[model samples]
Target chain A: MNRSALVSQAEPRDFIALLKPRVMSLVVFTALTGIVIAPGGVHPVLAAISLLCIAVGAGASGALNMWYDADIDALMGRTATRPIPAGRVTPGEALAFGLVLSVLSVLVLGLVANWLAAGLLAFTIFFYAVIYTMWLKRWTPQNIVIGGAAGAFPPMIGWAAVTGSVSLESLVLFLIIFIWTPPHFWALALIKSEDYARAGVPMLPVACGEAETRRQILLYTLVLAPVGMAPWFLGFAGLTYGVVAAAGGLGMIWLAIEIYRRREGAAARKASGRMFAFSILYLFALFAVLLVEQGILARIL
Target chain B: MAEQPTEAGIVLTPEEKRRQRQRNIAIALALAGLCVIFWIVTMVKGAAILQRPM
Candidate 1:
């Protein structure tokens, strides 16, 4: 993370760094799932390109976000080492890079798949960079709540790539991510309240007391659990998806309760961290289970 | 102790403004290239689809 260490390399990884590879990977996986699970088939080459664009677009959004938040990022311990904050990339450079990539991703996906998918992808980058980061982030406790919709678009975009329109299945995928974001992020916010506080970001835990935040998390999970099962209930997904989603929901609730119960100490903090980490795993699993059931396991199970 | 010396809205230096302009131009150009490519691909795909027998 040291700037000097990264600076001397003759070859710069600057372009690759912009994409937020960790986030891109998840976006790729979910988007791919959307393509495969949707009704019609996309040509393999086109599918590859579409997914590539989605990844690039997601990265572009991340870069733009980093550009805007560079000052705040440097202040927060967790974000201080990002390329923009570390001075590896300038804010203008990052913004330009992101803007270029965002345009490319949307166009490529539109060309390779459908304009609808590309249009959605373009809107997603806009929502994330302009709306979420530029407008909503510093202004509201609902930052992640509303901003969550932007991240939730990948699977929908992927589904659109195949079907060329939105459907019940895609919406369900959107709902899972939408509902998951608050609790998932709130868990981290609970732990990193100091980082957000220092940055003057009005995250939920900082705005409302810990108890109220915990209540909000639990309430969101209560809604999320039911929404997660909706695909199965609506007949877009199989029973296995229902069962797994139900289990994951309960598991998430259990951790949320533990977080609420143990709010004051190292153990409570660790519990929140545990939930934050597990929530990620839970989402991936929930999607993976949906894919398996709808595509492969539907026949056997 | 390590916060940026300037506040969030500090005016960009001349060098920074120049960099920003260049970046803006580059982004605009890249976006144009993407549009060109997207159109070409879609046209090719559409032609192929139309050629196919129903």
Candidate 2:
């Protein structure tokens, strides 16, 4: 069958799927947390606008990624059902959709929020779409290590939307996600190494072997443990945040250790799956604690 | 006149046509909502809106 002929007419739902709503939700949550924890004020409406722009920009990046990666996505079992690869949307259509959303998001953010926030949003789109997707993803095993910066930018952009400037506090938030990404992704890579290998993408486990990838996941988690607690230690957060960070950091390290110790068969896959699932909760709990301390609890007390 | 078919020669059934209409309406509504938002924001910012450093 002719590949182009396989493409069906795209529906609105297909376009929505192209946006990768699950990934966009994570971006929105973390970015909203950044806004809540920042040590300044923005009008409620403006804050909402900033969040909307961030979410759209993240979606735009996802769409562009899907368009460019349609080939590999078709090959990989995990991504084969995605809109472009599933023949529900054409790559040209995805490209146009992403590009339009990218421009609209940046322009709207700049008009409603400060240009600094808008610029960060723009750079984030470029970093994810071009730098990570186009260049690093296929080229190196360290792709997630460096490309993690794209995901890390959202909080900083959110903080800038509120304060009109980047601060040490926002950078701490950035560093937390940046450091957390490697372990989070490597755990999944350990399980999906075959998918990545089939797609010709040099994920850590595929490129460097599972044993080395597991070791790297442990090392990154060790570093993340201290860095994740840095905000609480530095007094940017309260005692409640401090406790949650300590507990979550310990949980993350334990999971990483489990992944390292159980290195074969179904046990290893189970360990990696547990680590990946817990990593999401770990990051979410850290930010949720901060949001409560700085946004809600601060207001109440 | 015969109904025009898509380039793929797939003619839309009535249900598909209804869905396409709904999608177009949704897109229009979303665009209208965005314009309304921008207008409200501009009003709120007022003279200070132009003072933004690009």
Candidate 3:
């Protein structure tokens, strides 16, 4: 073996890429909303630290996921350019990085915030790394349906950080994300069914067929629309939030209907693509509204 | 004397060396940030930082 070939050529950016920053950003945003919305406020510094810990923990999960999924990632066009699959970072290096960050983030969160948050963070990492990536991903078509719980946890963890316990409100936040995941992912799956089929991953579109996937997308969206508005109706938010949620929920439903109605040609692909794109906006707008509303209320009262 | 190879008996190329340096710097910065956070939290907690909640 050539010693020269054994030396890593990975850059620091590759390490960052391993963390899945885009996913981390969403986690941070949702978690931050959780922190801000809790009744009694946290110290600004502590809150910042908690957010940091959550973000790093989420990143750690991402790294661990990439480390384990490298082979399948290499096969899928969507994931082919990931750090490990792209040959920028080794799986061993990614695993080490993930493990180190996971421990550090959890410990720091426990020390700076509360143990509940830390415990949730730890479980979130374990779920994403072990349950979802290692076990569920290749085994079932319903992989993301259950794996979405890992993503749903941040806001609850954030709420726990502030209140030192879980509550109904936090669980509602969790429910919204959990329901939203199926439609959001299935729309993308509808488009990239071939990539998933190639990777031997049993996403709904690959395993259950496109018609079933589209029907499921519509079903989940119907559920998500009402759940997305629960925060407003539940009294944590004001009229603006209610209005935005209602509008976004309608938009999501409309797009989902389009996805269900249009079933072939570029029109079908376009419907799926539009649904995929709009789902992101729908979720982002929902969280952003909650964050803004709660932020202003927190400041005023 | 020639440049020494690492304990693994592999010589790092110039690009590898540069990246290693970059990673080391990032690690140092991260450590420093953690220290600052710990210190600030200690000050905020004011001698009761150890009384953690379950």
Against the hidden reference, what TM-scores do the models get? 0.83, 0.94, 0.96
All candidates' chain B TM-scores are 0.65, 0.71, 0.76
Clashing pairs in 1: none
Tens-digit lDDT track for model 1 on A1-301? 4433322221135556777888888898888889878886667766777888888899999989888888899999999988877776767767877888788787667657778998899899999999999888999999999999999999999999888899988988998899999999999999999999999998999888678888888889888888888888898887778888889989998988888788788988998898899899989988898778775565456
Candidate 1: C-alpha RMSD to true structure equals: 7.4
DockQ of each: 0.07, 0.35, 0.52
lDDT of 2 by residue, A116-210 (tens): 99999999999999999999999999998999999999999999888889999999999999999999999999999999999999998998899
Per-residue alpha-carbon lDDT of candidate 2 for residues B1-54, written as tens digits (9 for 90 to 100): 114445656556565677578778868987998988888888788887787753
Over 4 Å off, model 3? A2-5, B1-8
Where does model 2 sit among the CAPRI classes? acceptable
What's the residue-level lDDT of B45 in candidate 3?
82
Best TM-score among the predictions, by candidate number: 3
Superposed Cα deviation of residue A299, candidate 3 (Å): 2.1
Model 1 backbone overlap count? 0
In order of DockQ, best first, we have 3, 2, 1
Candidate 3: C-alpha RMSD after superposition: 2.2
Q: Which regions of candidate 2 are displaced past 4 Å?
A: A1-8, B1-10
